[model samples]
Target: MVFEDLGIMPAILEALKGEGYINPTPIQEKAIPILIKGKDLQGCAQTGTGKTAAFAIPILQRLSQNPLQKQGPKPIRTLILTPTRELAIQIGESFASYGKNVNINHTVIFGGVSQGAQVDALRRGVDIVIATPGRLIDLNNQGLVALNKIEIFVLDEADRMLDMGFVNDVKKIIKLIPKHRQSIFFSATMPDSITQLASSILTQPQYVEVTPVSSTAETIAQELYFVDMVNKRDLLLHILKDKELKSILVFTRTKHGADKVVKLLERESIKAAAIHGNKSQNARQKALNDFKDKKLRVLVATDIAARGIDIDELELVINYEIPNIPETYVHRIGRTGRAGQIGKAISFCDSDERIYMRDILKLTKINIPVANEHPFLPAEGNTDLSTAVKPKAKAPLPRENRPRNHAYGSTSKGGNGQRKRENSF
Candidate 1:
């Protein structure tokens, strides 16, 4: 349904229209109404389902209707706690975009950068504060932020926060907020710990769930390659050669793994970048922006860093390394096939990672089609499933001793742009 039917204010509706937002996503359609009614909500939705707008729009509308008159330089009326700086910034951007017509001011605060600018923003006063837990607690400890005034509290990516070991910090923040205020909670998946945490803070919250993390989207074509660990990189380069895999998001299990993937792709004269916790905030943001703008064709990222990446036309997600957590696999591939668009999730599984692959299969209850016709196919074992794909001629890999100076160019004629249709069963 259209966003207008959700009772969004004309000002916020105009801003949404300016952003070209037409229909409300499922999460938005369900959660917006409950949130606008001044009720606590628990939303279980995966990344790229427009979770930002579901909460941001209603918060902005609520604040606008009852403008804070206790103004001594606007105390924060809404506080959003996310797990990462990148996500905090993106949520802050969403508030700015959706609240432009509402005349609400908001700022994002995170660690890894000097608190000078964030402190300045706080001193100047803001209606909303979007922040990461660590920096938010640190600043509050230093008496820099006054959160007692918060009326609307949002704990976003709750599972990620707990996975990142921010449970204690979240608890501390919850204690600071007024007990009677409206609280909104979101998580990709909810474990018992998350359930307990929600019960402690929320008062009979309305639950809204869509596309549970255990399930992958039916629109995404899942492809698997059984390659040796050493040859997984080659498989990636080989697949990229098809030129049909445009704007790919590659996931690695570690910060170093992400960087290594980026370096390996660069050696083949492929433009790529890596984003992880170790990278400076600016570096990570630049890499993300470059990938979104299509200046860089590939962005290798660790799972935590990839949170809140909302790219609509992202067509491909490559799992260079399988995650130990089955649900993480869902989150990784969910980056593509967003907003009802068809996408592809291609994974490379080595013999050692077979267990991880098995876990993912058990969790999703879907057998990812194995693409067995690649050159890097493991020589032995059941790693390469005997699937129905007809074996095609193998492509030659560049010699290890070859110089890395060959420049790559965009090919006018590439493989058919059609996505491979396989029974994902």
Candidate 2:
């Protein structure tokens, strides 16, 4: 449906036009109306669903339509809590773009950088504060920010917050805010934890689910590549030989893996960059900007670091390391095939990660066609899928015995499990 039908104001509509957004996605179509009514909303959707605009647009309209009495400085009227710095910054940018003509100002609060400027912005006053829990709490403790005046409270990427061990911090922030505020909760998936969190935060919220939690987009063609763990770099290089993949997002399980992949690509003179928790904020932003500008052929990132990455017409996503969590596979490929556009997801799987592939296949309930057209077959040169899962000469290492690389929330073994909270930042 067109945004005008969704109750968007004329000025915001004009702003959207300048941004090239005329129609709303399904999530936006459903969630925007309910949110514009000022009702508590619980949205279950994934990345690429345009969920940001679903809430951002309504928020700008509401705040603008109901102008509050003039005060000395703007108190925080809205609090949007997200998990990562990247997602928080992206949300802030969305607010700026959509609320340009409106009388609202937002300051993004994140870690990995000094808070001097963030504090300055807060002191100057803002109508909204889009923040990560840790930094917000830090500023709140120092009396630099306050949320008691919040009229709208939004918890974006709730599942990711819990996964990143920010649940306690989120609960703390909720306690600090007005309990009577209109709560907006959005999560890619609704596990029991997310369900309970929503129940506690939202009061009689209207449920708007645009997509099933377990499924991938039908517009995406899924392809699987079975290769040896040692030959993964070679397989990736071979795939890059296809110049048609003008821009590719490669997901690695760890920061070290991401760096290693970027190094391999750079050595071959293929422009590439890696983004993860370890990289500085400026470096990460530069890499992301480069990738968005198509200046980098490959942008390798870990799962958490890739949050809130919305690239227009991005058609390809590569899984350099298969994730143990099947649900994660859904989020990864969701980066492509955005807004009903056709896209492709190519996954590289080794014998060690066959279990992950099976889990993903079972969760998605679709047999991903093995792309055997590539020349990365084994010594036997067979294209059989089961051959990769066949018996091996040496037994696999136990989870504890394996060397682990901490990417974003690296657990005892590896992968995007839970890590410590962002307390210091």
Candidate 3:
């Protein structure tokens, strides 16, 4: 259905047309109506599902329809809490684009940078505030921000927040807001932790789900390559020789791994960049812009840094390192095949990571055809899919034993994992 049928205002409809968005995505079609009614909502959809517009459009309409009397500067009427600075910034951009003609104003604040400018923006006043949990709390504690004026509270990327260990901070922010406000919780997957968190925050919320985690986009062509862990880099370099696989996104599991991949690619005289927790805010933004503009041939990223990445006609995604969680595999591949474009997702699996491949196959419930024509294929390759050996069952690693590449949270088992937020600006 078209966006007009979803009750979006004329201003937003015009803005969307300028942005070349005529039809509504499935998530947008279902979630916008409930949210426009000022009802609490719980949405489960994967990345690249246009969920940002689903909420941002209605928010702009509501705030514009009910204009409040201004005393000095407008207090923040809506608060949107997200896990990463990238996603927070993207949401703020969405608000700006959709509300350009409206009277509402919004700003985004995150950690990893000096707060002087953010504080100055807060002082100037805004109607909507998009922020990461840590920086928001820091400003709130310093008496620079106030959430008591919030009429609508949004917790975007709830599952990612749990992955990043922002539950306590989220709970703290929830307590500060007025309890009578409307709430919206959106997550890619409803893990038990996210479900419980949604239950505590939402009051009789309406549920909307689209494109379950187990499914992948039909436009994507999936393939797998088996190689030794030591030769994965060589395999990647070899694959790039085609020159047709332009603008590829390579995923690594850790920050160090991402950096290592970048260095290796550079040594071969390939123009590439890395985005992760270790880079400065300016550096990360520059790298992302370069990749999007086709200045760089490759962009190496970790799972967290890649959450809010949206690029058009980005047809190639290479999994340099497979993720441990099966659901993560779906998220990684979903980066491509976006906006009605056909895409390709190629995965590199080493001997030790075969178990991960097995789990991914089980989760997607489809067998990925193996590409055996590559030059870097392992000597004992092409094993029987049904008889692949699983990793030996063992106790989880201790906190100190697990690698500390992520910005926040530990390698702990319980979802109560705690870590610092806003490591990357």
Best-fitting candidate, scored by lDDT: 3
Encode model 1's per-residue lDDT on 151-223: one tens digit a residue: 9999998998887789999999998989989999999888999998888879999999997568899989999
218 Cα displacement, candidate 2 (Å): 8.6
Question: Each prediction's TM-score against the native?
Answer: 0.65, 0.66, 0.66
Model 1 accuracy (lDDT, Cα): 0.77
Question: Per the 3 Å backbone cut-off, how many clashing residue pairs does candidate 2 have?
Answer: 0
Task: Report the lDDT of model 2 for residue 206.
Answer: 98
**Predicted structure with the largest TM-score when compared to the true one:** 3
lDDT (CA) per prediction? 0.77, 0.79, 0.80
- Models, CA RMSD each: 11.8, 9.6, 8.8
Per-residue C-alpha lDDT of model 2 across residues 1-425, encoded as one tens digit per residue: 78889878998898677555777889898999899999999999876577888888888889889878986887889899988765665576567556666677778787656678788788888888888888889999999888889999999989988977899999999999998888999998899989999999999999999754588999999999988788889999999999888989999976678999999999999999998766755687799899989899889988766755688788699999887657779988999998989999999987777767887887899989997777776555544444346223432311211333331111011112222111010
Ranking by lDDT: 3, 2, 1
Candidate 3 residues 1-425, lDDT tens each? Answer: 78889988898788677555788888989999999999999999765577888888899899989999757988989999988765665576567556766777777777766677777778888888888999899999999999999999999989988877889999999999999998999998898888999999999999999975688999899999988778998899998888887789999976678999999999998899998755654677799999999999999998766755687888799999877667779989999998788999999987667777898899899889998888888877655556556544331111212323333211111011221121211
Clashes of each: 0, 0, 1
Model 3: CA > 4 A from native: 191-196, 216-221, 226-234, 243-344, 349-359, 369-425
Question: On a 0 to 100 scale, what is the lDDT of residue 42 in model 3?
Answer: 97
